[model samples]
Target: MPHRSSTLNRRLVRYAFATLFAALSTQAAWAASFDCGQAKQPDERAICASRQLSEMDVEMAVRYDTLTGLVAMGTRGDMQDEQRAWLHERAACRGDRRCLRASYTKRIDTLKREYDQLKSRGPF
Candidate 1:
């Protein structure tokens, strides 16, 4: 009957929309700061769990790498020590989403500021 066809069309539209939304959400959830395949710690796993945190991780990693290469050999040791301390602080977040978010935000901000200052000094 005509009524049956209408009902089926509506159901198909609903199904399609639901499927599209689900796919988008899943992709966003894993926006991923690092390669999930290489995640080796609870904090790393936590960072991978949320797109925002993952973004923060990616930015931090990039800045850290850039600064390390730009710094002098002697100060590179100090930078390594500072980065290790930050890692310990991040690890203390322990899968707590709020804590991890805060940690990432703070670290990202700190790295950006430090990087800006170093760049302004025109290399040591």
Candidate 2:
């Protein structure tokens, strides 16, 4: 009876780990699918676009935090211009949330164009 119980316990542990691994793998796949440029299906494209918007929101928030930090550090003149440009780019990339929610492809394209323009303008 003890031997049978031990075997069952081991099996249960194995099953638990397997379940956890599967869940993690699925999450990773979902994240990978959320890259707007990598979607192959229409549904996937929409999902990717939504994910991109969410990511842009997070990025903008981070840029705002950085701007605040720079201000705290007494950034001035050209430094201020650079930081302001960075903030502008972040805001542009964020685009219109309503439009993004209504149409993912257009919003993604807008973001990509804004990002490219920012990159061409040099670093902040």
Candidate 3:
């Protein structure tokens, strides 16, 4: 059996790697979806200003992209329209960082769930 200290160390390493993976995915999401230089909305500006919000935005974007690609061709338009509506709702949160963060969190969670559904599908 493994020693307690070694087990603790292994768990810590896994946690660290998970954190690192999340950080990297969020960064890529931000870069892939928006040009920070031209960000105009209050929420966009706020996202650009805060690391947490920016990370959420990126994470959500990545999940959205993945889910969209995974879903059927016939459903693509609906997915995109739903995303647009969500964006409008998110933007309505305006300068409230808490509201914006909550919005991002909910959307990211939803998209992540949808993305996970792809795991059961065969590779095309």
Name the best candidate (by lDDT).
1
Off by over 4 Å in 3: 1-32, 121-124
TM-score of each: 0.67, 0.25, 0.69
- Per-residue lDDT of 26-113 in model 3, one digit per residue for the tens? 7444442588888888888888877788778778887887778777887888889889999999989998999998998889878777
Rank candidates by TM-score, best first: 3, 1, 2
lDDT of 1 by residue, 1-124 (tens): 9999999999999999999789667765455646787888888888887777887887888888888898788888988998899989988888888998888788778778878988898855
What TM-score does candidate 2 reach? Answer: 0.25
Ten consecutive residues with minimal summed lDDT in candidate 2? 27-36
Mark the regions of model 2 whose C-alpha exceeds 4 Å error after superposition: 28-124
Q: What is the C-alpha local distance difference test score of each model? A: 0.82, 0.51, 0.81
Q: What TM-score does candidate 3 reach?
A: 0.69
Winner on lDDT (1 vs 3): 1
